[model samples]
Target: MSHVRVAIPKKGFERFEKYNPENLKSFEQLIEEQNGDTYCLKLNMHLLRMYNAYPQLVNLKITRLILLKALSKLPYQHFNFARKYLIWSQLIDDGIRVIIDMADLLENEDYEEFWMHYKQKATILPILDGFDEAIRKYICFKVGSTRTTVPCMEFKMKLAVDKEVLMKYITQLGWMINGNEVKVFPLMLNDSNDRDVIRGIICSDIR
Candidate 1:
């Protein structure tokens, strides 16, 4: 096999040999073979995760530079996922930042937009899901209310549906309709409140 250049772009790749000890050519072995290159080592997303930089990979014929190129043109870093390994945050760069920017759609509560844009990146959907769930569930956000000065369009939308009766069912109302995800603004739900978020919690307890 030929020597692979190890360049550390903004992509999430670290040379952790244990991740893929299965590979015959270890990082040490590769380093011994290479003559000289400023780029120490490089791996694509899957290769990185397989080597334990993160937790997983996508089964596609993708390349490190290609992923980095795509990520380089992106605008942000860090994304939400359902089952992610946050321990490997050190593998950050413009490329990974771009990949994380994809999570901005979920954070901004633009499901339609999110799906529309990154649905194709679904090859890495599992990884994306990990980050998405991690981000949305942990980040604190409050439901919108007329009494509060902060803008909460999700809450306001509930108010618009039926100002008087909406509050009556605010906690249980189905104000959002993006695909099959009926719950609206679930990330901001606080179980104590009598609004959209709390209703689901109370209903589950009753059942």
Candidate 2:
């Protein structure tokens, strides 16, 4: 598989080395600006090094920051981002391994296994706000885009949420619930001409 190589900024690391309680807020802002880039991965590694140097600096906030940065890479790097951090296991904990496994499951669309791991190990670090909601959005997008209709029970299982919550999500997407199934509309097309042509082809194929 091909991968994009992102150049890490040396100046960023130089500035990161000066991070302390006094400047942590600013440091966080700098890193957040670099989110979704490979530079964030390097920053996370630097954070692990700092934690190793001063174990007292390790806290829920720090761990959550690292985990969030790792998660931000999921769309581009998938589990590879998690795996890159495994070399520091002696300094950290098994949380990296758990994240790697969970990421792999999610990438493979194995929502059941992902939830099992999430529920089992979520307490290892700080609670990731909106984690479930983000995963649910991905599930809805993936299943809804492909399937015109899905069994309500199956959709609930895929989202790993209760019926009430599922209803809210589907309703927000403008889907209709009929007995045991939920209807999913195709994605909207912005261009009316293209939309008409696509609809005609679909109708002809169905007929």
Candidate 2 per-residue C-alpha lDDT over 1-207 given as tens digits, one digit per residue, 9 for 90 to 100 = 433333345644344334454444444445555533334444555555455555565543555556655554334342343344333433345665566567778778898888888898877644555557767776776776689999999889988889889889988999998889999976442455434543543353344
Q: Which candidate is the best by lDDT?
A: 2
Q: Write the per-residue lDDT of candidate 1 for residues 12-119, one digit (tens) a residue.
A: 334463355444234434433332232222322234344343334322222222232222222222122111322344235433443455555544655445545554
lDDT of each: 0.35, 0.60
Candidate 2 TM-score, true structure as reference: 0.58
Worst 10 residues of 1 by lDDT: 74-83
User: Residue 175 of model 2: what lDDT?
Assistant: 93
Off by over 4 Å in 1: 1-20, 23-99, 107-112, 118-124, 127-207
- Each prediction's TM-score versus the true structure: 0.25, 0.58
